[model samples]
Each structure stands twice: as C-alpha cells, then as structure tokens.
Target: MRTPTRFKAGAVILSAVALTVTACGTGGGDTSGGATADAGSGTGEIKVWGHQGEEGEVAALQAAVAGFNSSQKGVKATLQLIPSADYTKTVSATSPDQLPDVLEYDGPLMASFAYDKKLAPVEGLVSAQTIGNQTDSVKTQNTYQLDKKLYGVSMYDSGLGVYGNKALLDAAGVTYPKGLGDAWTADQFQTALEKLAAKDPDQKVLDVKENYGGEWPTYGFLPIVNSAGALAIKDNKAEGNLNSAPVVKAVQQFAGWRKFVDPNSDDKAFTDGRVALSWVGHWQYNPYNKALGQKLVVLPLPDFGAGTKSGQGSWAWGIGGSSKNGKAAGLFLDYLLNDSNVTAMTTANAAPPGTKTVIATDPLYKPGGPLQLFADGLSKTCGANPPTTACVATPRPVTPAYPVFSQQFSQAFLNIYKGGDAQAELDKAAKAIDQDFTDNNNYTS
Candidate 1:
C-alpha cells in the first residue's frame, strides 16, 4: 500500500516505438533460442515492477512475493521499483523483456492499456466472486473496459476526503462536517466555510489564488457537480451542462465560500490553517496528519445538493500482456488480493481497503471514519470506464485518446473556476473534444 503523492507536471515522454518493442517478445526464445517447458520455472526469472514508495509501503507485496517464492519451487520473482515520475511512461513502453509477469498500474492508465490490448484478461485466474465480492466499485473499475473482462485486481482502495485541523475548527468554534452519508449540501457546506472564515475576518480559510485553486476545483468540486446532477462527460462526449442550472448553481455557491476564505491567495489560505478543512485524499493521512500534529480530523468531502453520493477514484494491479508467465503472474495476483494482503497494504499506506472482507476486518478503519464514507460513496459513484456505451456495445472500446481528453476537461474546468467565460470556455473545450474523438474515429456523431 502506497499513499500517492502528486506528480510533477512534466517528466519524461514515452516513445511509442519503445513501448511497442518492449511489449512484443524478442526473437530469441530461451537460453538456447528455443521455446522450453521451463520458461517460467525456477530456472527462469520473473520480473515484477511497480512505483517506488516509503520503506513500509510495499511490505505486504514483498511478503506475498516471498511467500510465493518459498511455496513454489518452480519460479523465482524479482522486484523492480520505478519512480512515480516515469512510471506511466516506463510501463507503457515495456519491451517483452522489460514487461513484468505481473505489475501494478494506476486505474486510468490500466483503462488505457486495456483499450490498447496491452493487458491480458485475468478472467480464469481469479473468481469474480472472490474479487468482486470485496468491493463492487473496485470490481467495476478493474473490469471497466472491454466487455467487463477482468484486466486487473484492486490492491487497495482510496478516495478523496477533507483533512481538517481539529484545533483550527475548535479555535474557530466550528463543528466538523458529517460523513459522506450525512454530508452537508452545497449551501450548508458554504455556510460552514463562511462561518469559519468570519470567525477571523483577517484570516484566510479556503485557498483559490493559484491557478484558481486548480486541484481543489477538480477533486473537491467534482462531487458537488455530481450532487447537482451535472455530468462532466457523458458517453465519451463533453457536456456543456457544466454551466447549466444545477452546475452553475453549485459553482456559484462554492465561489461564495471562496470569497469568505482566501479570495486572493491559495497558499496563505491552506498553510495558515485558517482554513478549517482542506480537500485531500485518504493517502494524505500521514503527511497532513503529521503536519497538523494532534490537530487532524479526517472526514468525507461534504456532499452538495440533494444527491446521496460522491465521486471516487481508485487504483488497481494489472498483468502485462507481453508476459510469458501468465500462470505465475495469476498466482501472484491472487495472493495480492487476498484479504490479509490487502488489509496489510492499505493499513500501511493509510488507504482504504478495496475488498469488503478486508474493509470489514481492517483495524485502521474506525466505525465512522473517512473509510466508511468511502465505502458508502463507492456504492453510488460512477466510473470512467466500461463507458456509458457499455450497455449497447460488446467489448466496448474506450477511446485510446482518453488521457488527452481528461486534460482538456481539466483545463476547461480550470478556466471556469478562474473566472473565464464559463459558457465560452466550455464551448471551446467541447469543440476540441469533438475534434479529438472524430480524429480518432471514436465519436458517435
């Protein structure tokens, strides 16, 4: 389990050619240049790769790998740590030799890989009941592409939440908001922010100065949009309803709260601790909690409007398509998803457990903490894959250009939040999206 930190904007560009080479098998088959029955046996080596993290973060995975190696006399497993900065590029560019028998991949990247057929289905390897029964949303994310074929297994669970400074709230004489199930409506949430800000008129509460609160406007505001019944994108199409009645109403309400908080600067608002609540992820538990010392209180993002749910994001582990050791990879994946392994990882990483059995038994989860809120939100949230067209198509093809599309969407939302002409910005973004879809032959119209 690894709590993900933000990545730098520009790192390394992955060459498609390199990816192709790495993904396809090299001509030489074995040590003797011929296919052999012991290809994946102890005489052969299996490479496994994933992002690097804190020492204890991957202990569970290491333990599981150790167990597999000790129990199976046929195979030897080797681990490779890829820096998060180049992880996506490196994974996407895997040569047959570079590709791991089993690997961990972020969910959106996994979706893209599935679209490209760079991943192999794990349908027969693990029972849907075993994985699916753990967390329906995770199962949905894992099989979100290509006719619901299982491409990966969820290693752990995580969701967005508000990391509050309890002392700050107490100092402001404000009450902590309820869990997602009992989250505050848009107006109610704003009112809380306003009250917190008013307690110290000269102090800042919410940050929006830099890039107009780019990060928060995306994650924090997403659920509000959903609660307001606005869809960011529907059926691979960008929706202008972002400025529609419900969405605009939600934004306006949020903007009002922003005014009371740091209407001018993003840094001062959050760092000053005048902001009683900061929208963040479950992975931020350690760093943020440590920053606040004993002042931290984790809570779900406040629900806005009448909706009973919130939006969520999750990650999973996927097996590379180019690997020759499918059997061994499957066994490794099975061990990773077992309740004990999942629990150990999530607990160490400060993330929520993805499986039902793990979540139920994990000691890290308190009865009414943010983990419970995430479990509740998962039941209501929608995923980006399997696409809205899955109901009509068999083995749906998610556009290979989804990452580009997501960037455009993020930019458009940024423009709107920055006080740009909302309708105009949306129209521009819609046009670009339509063009992208059409150029890729992924659009319906």
Candidate 2:
C-alpha cells in the first residue's frame, strides 16, 4: 500500500533531502544499454519488484504474483518487495541489466525513468485489451508514451477532494458542491469555512491534514495553484508559469485559510467532529465513513477562479529497459491487471481502480456512490496543457526533470504554508527548476 497521504510536520524538511538524494544520478536522456530492440520476443524467468506496503497490500501483491506464476509453464515469475522510500534509489543505483524484469514506480516518475532509458514501452508487450481497459485518467498519468507507445500501466490510481460532515454543514447553512460542475467557488468555500468555524469549539472548521508534510503538500495543495489558473511548468520552463501572478495569488489565498484549519495532530480532527470538512484522499474514506456513518458525504474541491482541480496519479508498473524476460514479464503484468486482481488490490488499499470495468463495479467509486465525485473528477483531467476551466483533475507535470521539479515546487508551497512570502518562495523554486532543466540539456536526448 502507499504511505499515508499526510506526513508529520517535520517530514516536510526531510522529504526535500530524501528526494534530492534519491534522484541524484537520474538525469540525462541516454538510451545506452536500454531495451531498444523488440522485447516481445524474449521469454523465461521474469523478476518483479514492488514497493513493500502494509500487510494487506503486500498480501494482495503476493497473491497476484502467485496466481500469475501458477497460470503459466513457459515462464516463471518471482516477486521481491522493497521499501517504498528506497525503491527509487535502489533502482537508480542498479545497472540496467541488473534491474528487475518488471518494476513498480510512482506514476508521475514514469517520465523521468523513460527519459533516462530505465523503462521500455509496454505497448507491444502487454495485451492491447489490457491497456485499452484502463481509465482515461490512468492513461493520462502514464503519459511517458513517446511516439504513442505506453511505457507503464497501473493496477490502481489515487484521488483527492473534500469530505464533509452533513450535520455540521447543514447546521452552518453551508451548501457544499455535489460534483465537479457545482464545486464551491473560492468565496463560497471561505464563507463556508467561516460559518463552520463559528459553530466549532476551537473555531477550526477544516482539516487539510496540516500535521503531515512531505508529498502531502504537493499532492493535496498543488490543485489550488492549478485551480487558480496556473501551471507549475509550461513549455518546459517553470520561471513564468510557476511564479506567475495567478500562482502567487493562489498561495496567498490558501495561506489566508489557515485560521479555520485544524492541525489534526492526532489525525482525529474530522473523525472526532473537530472539523466540519476534510481535504484529503480516498485512503481516509473507510475511517471517515465509519466514524460519521450517515453524516459523511464526499464533495468536490473548491473552484479557485479557473476551475476545481483535484490530484490523480499513483504507483504504476513498467518493464525494465534491459529486461530479457520482457515477454514473460508482460504476461504477469497483464494477469496482475486483470479485473479480479485489480479488485483484490483496490479492496485492500481502498484506492480507485485503474480499469474502467472495475471502476464501474466499485462500491465507493461507482455512480451514485459515496465517492463517485472522485471518479467523476478523474473523467475531466487537465492534460499537458488543459484549458483554464472545465477540468477537474490535473496530473502532475510530465518531465524528466520532475524529480527536481516536484521537489522545488513542493518545498516552495510548504514554505508558503508556513508563512514565507509566496512570491519569493515560488520565484526561487522556479529558478532552481529552470536551472536543473538547463543542466540536463532540456532533457531532449
């Protein structure tokens, strides 16, 4: 399973350091020793590596691998689990030939890997039907599809939005958005927060999971920037887009909402009724629903002038560029993505399913379901350069410099959240990102 979306406050500082160290040697666009030749022709032993997760997640993965191994005789697949934190570093340090036949990586990182030639296109290897069955959002997340060739596929994806307390909302006379089309405007959201705060013991009506940091800031708060009509990067440059007026203003506006936010140190602000609204992801659904029962309801994120944008992307699978067992690996990968296997994984992690068929049958994400808003949000993704409005989901930027790109933007946002000057922080991050891009020769190799 993925780590909790929120991290302890101090993890913010540590995340930057860990990410820097993890992505140190992963620059350039070299294809040397990469699997440029057709890989569908190879077969035999297939090695697969996945992030080590919780007991249930780990069990689900193990079961899938077992099923795949038993279903065939021409090839044998072996599974290995690595700590999520160290998975990237381990892969980066390994020679291409030493890498696993198939490896799981964070969805947004696929561009970086593909640029570095650490991944091979999964288009011809995996079954066409398996690839076609994926949701539109999943396809967008795995956008490293150079020359129209897909490089990765995921069994499940992630979602982000608001979870409201029906009683608290009604008592405050606040009307929350039911779906993407009716998301609350910035004014409406702020007013709702104020009203909800007035009825709270501590005057904190919202929980943005402040006690957490790390990727949490980027994953949870970047949408505010997007919704405010700004792209973190545009045309392979960050200077103008990321530090633009819209982005700075969005950060300032978001910072202004701190007064109504619960720190949620014990992660009980929402579950304990200390907060009327929770801005989180699908991972918290079970607990939030269990605690509030009939009072719990899922709502769309606030529309920040441009539109309501939410975050979507998660761990996905890709073939190693140097894999000799690419054909065999594809077989296991296809099996792992089958409907039953996808259901098993989604059931264990409580994430949105990657495939369209599975999503249609999911209890939480299906139409008229409690979390249907999340599914609906995914259907309206703002791709590489989406229009200012009419989009609900925004995939993280696709770039080989993303490791540095994400690190810089996330740290800048965290600084803004902690009271740093928004313009200054963003300007600094944008410059650093552009410099990295220059150092990597624009990653056009």
- Any runs in candidate 2 off by more than 4 Å, and if so which? 1-14, 26-42, 145-148
Per-residue lDDT, model 1, residue 171, is 72
- Highest TM-score: give the candidate number: 2
lDDT of 2 by residue, 1-445 (tens): 1134322111122255545643455544553312442465556778888987656778999999888878877778889998766666676667666778899877777777777667888877889999999888888878663444577888888889899999999998888787788889888899999888887888988999877655777778888889988888887789988898977887888888998988888889899998999998888898888899999988888887898888988888989987876777788888999999999998987888989999999998899888888888887888776537877888887776777877888889888888999999999999999998787667665
Shift in Å, residue 438, candidate 2: 0.7
lDDT (0 to 1) per candidate: 0.55, 0.79
lDDT of 1 at 173: 70
Per-residue lDDT of 260 in model 1: 59
TM-score, per-candidate, Cα-based: 0.78, 0.94
**Cα lDDT for residue 24, model 2?**
52
Off by over 4 Å in 1: 1-44, 95-98, 127-130, 166-176, 207-220, 240-245, 260-272, 287-296, 306-311, 366-370, 383-399, 443-445
Show the lowest summed lDDT stretch of 10 residues, model 1.
Answer: 388-397
Query: Which residue pairs in candidate 2 have backbone atoms (N, alpha carbon, C) closer than 3 angstroms, thus clashing?
Result: 7-212, 7-213
How well is each residue in 1-445 modelled by candidate 1, as lDDT tens digits? 1111341111112334423332232322211111111124323567788776545656767887787678767667788878754676676665534567777766544445655445667765556566565566666556643355667777665566566778777876777666554555555666667677767666556543333321233443555555565555555566564445666666555544545545533334444566677665555556665567667775655554545334343456766666677766666676667777776677777666777777766655546553566555565445543212111101111344445544555577666666766566666766776666565445221
